[model samples]
Target: MATAAKKESKPNAGFMKPVTPSKILAEVVGTEPMPRTEVTKKVWDYIKKHDLQDAANRRMINADAKLEAVFDGKKQVSMFEMTKLISNHLKA
Candidate 1:
């Protein structure tokens, strides 16, 4: 009896495709078109750089003036909600 070879999983095409960020998002992530993964990374970088995460609750992200626009005027959002909010600012 022989063991079957493992199959590798490919990344989702949609996530890898380059997307343009809306003006509000561009202010945080820059104006260049980038993959969704990179956009998330950059957004997280900005959040970390600015110390925007809430001290009381690590999962909560406090929106600054620029981020408030991206977050649809929300003053604070959870880590999970952030991805959904950011999606609105990206276009294919």
Candidate 2:
């Protein structure tokens, strides 16, 4: 009897779709258009570089002057909420 061939999985296009960041978001992720995953990575990099994560609670993010604009004037936001807020600053 012949064995069945294995099927390869395709990458998710939605995650790879290019999105343009607003001016506020550009401050953290740069001005180039990139996939959402890359944007999230860049944001995390900036957060880490600036030591913006709350010392007491890692899940909380401390927004600086630059991030304040992106965060709609909020000084602090949760790690989970950060992604939701960031989405508002992105456009197709």
Candidate 3:
């Protein structure tokens, strides 16, 4: 007899929960409540639209005027650090 395939697990509820963004972050992601995943997506969209990724280092992001505030005056941040910095601008 053939064995059944394992079922896929659902995403974490906490991750899907909505959170409001701070004023600075709102400039980039808009003034609306969204899950952390969506917030990250919107930020990425803005980054791509503005071509903020460093050409020399693809893993680094160069903050623009709006992003500068969100990044806490940071001129550049790594992709990994971007997530941590963005979290500081989010609130449940």
Q: Which candidate is the best by lDDT?
A: 1
TM of each candidate vs. truth = 0.91, 0.89, 0.92
Model 3 misplaced stretches (Cα beyond 4 Å):
1-4
> How many clashing pairs does model 3 include?
0
Go through the candidates in order and give the clash count of each. Answer: 0, 0, 0
Please give, for residues 1-92, the per-residue lDDT of candidate 1 as tens digits: 43457667899999999999999899999999999999999999999999999999999999999999999999999999999999999999
> What is the lDDT for 51 in model 3?
100
Comparing 1 and 3 by TM-score, which wins?
3
Ranking by TM-score: 3, 1, 2
Predictions in order: lDDT: 0.97, 0.94, 0.95
Candidate 2's displacement at residue 67, Å, is 0.8
Residues 25-92 of candidate 2 have per-residue lDDT tens digits of 99999999999999999999999999999999999999999998988999999999999999999999
Instruction: Judging by TM-score against the true structure, name the best candidate.
Output: 3
Clashing pairs in 2: none
